[model samples]
Target: MRLKDKVIIVTGSTTGIGKAIAKAAISEGAKVLVHGLEEDLGLQAIQELGEENTVLHIEDISAAGCPEKLVELAIKTWGKIDAIVNNAAWVVNSDIGTTGKAFLGKVLEVNSIAPFLLIKSALPYLSVSKGVVLNIGSVNAWSGEPNLLAYSISKGALMTMTRNLGDVLPRTHSVRVNQINPGWVLTERERQHKKQDGLSENWYEEIPAMYAPSGRILWPSEIAAAAVYWLADESGPISGQVVDLEQHPLMGRNAPKDPSTIHGKP
Candidate 1:
């Protein structure tokens, strides 16, 4: 019960890593505002997390004033806010040639701007409670693959927002902010994304060892476990930190050479 009596808001929590974080917070004795765009998924989360301890908020976060509305609903349900996990994001495949102005605007609106708005909307409550904000970022922030140009840019903006707010909020309001840049998580959405990219149903099984370090990609639950540590007071008053959650070193690591190519056998 590390988070006993705390109230948390987790955006985009209807599925995947966001859903895992909501569940983990509740298990640690926190009441949560579970948010998502899908009503059905929101209902599923309410059923799983229990109505007594959870509030389901359905909204397109990129819409105007939705962030403030979400914070208001959390306060109405729980009387205060202890933390907010800005986990909702919109990702679409687009390279320099394919990324249009409309698409780029949409991507930035959801993936970058929405989180900033959520934090701003929740700032008053967070200050009152001396709360924390955990932003779920991506390792792709560090120059994503060419195909992920717009998405990479959006994440990079988010990473900057995290650090900027992390430094300012803690000093000015006693509210902490931190971010986690997760790598290659194996969620249902990810599986579907791979499928859309022409990967077969057995794609996970076919991932080369070079990609999946532990014979598998990262899991939402594993990310959730790390999140709880930051959300809880056990992490102290630390802020302005970005953790890259990946098996391989994010910096100064040589690309994995193909075994067959190196051995000249195949």
Candidate 2:
């Protein structure tokens, strides 16, 4: 019961890492407001999590005024908000050639702006509760793959927001903000996306050695497990921090042309 009696609003809780975090929070005795798009998926998640522990709110996270509405919904349901997990993201592939201003704008709206607005909306209650804010970011924020240009920029913005809020909010409002940068989680969305990209349905099972050091990527549950520590009082006064959760060192780790044969030839 690490999170006993806390009320957390988890955006994008209908699926993937967000859903996993909501589940873990509930198991740790937290009440969760599960927000997401896709009415059926939202209902399904609520059913799985049980109405006693959660309430469902379905909305496009990027829509205007959504942040305000979500804050209102959580307050209405739980009477106070203890924390928020900004986990909703708009992920689409784009490169230098395919990228456009409008596309970049929309991606930033979902990934970075919404989280900031949500925090702003919830600030009052959070101040009262001395709450926590956890932003779900990608390792790509450091500088992403070429194909993930706009998404990377959006995440980079989110990362900066996390750090900025983490610094000021904790001091002024006693609200702790932090970020988790996850690398290649094997979530439902990941599997689906890879399959859509023409990979075999079981592509995850046979990942290249360079990508999956341990024959697998991180799991949503694993990320959730780490999330619990930061969300709970256990983390104590730690703010303005960004943690990278990846199998290997993210920066300057060499990828061999043929690892099995080129072991000592680098």
Candidate that scores best on TM-score: 2
The digit string of per-residue lDDT tens for model 2 on 55-145 reads: 9889998898999999999999889999999999988899989999998999999999999999999999999999999999999999999
The candidate that achieves the highest lDDT relative to the unseen native structure = 2
Residue pairs with colliding backbones in model 2 are none
How do the residues 58-85 of candidate 1 rate in per-residue lDDT, one tens digit apiece?
9899999999999999999879999999
Which window of ten consecutive residues has the lowest lDDT sum in model 2?
Answer: 257-266
Candidate 1: clashing pairs of residues:
none
Please state the error at residue 197 of candidate 2 in Å: 1.0
- Model 1 lDDT-worst window of ten: 257-266
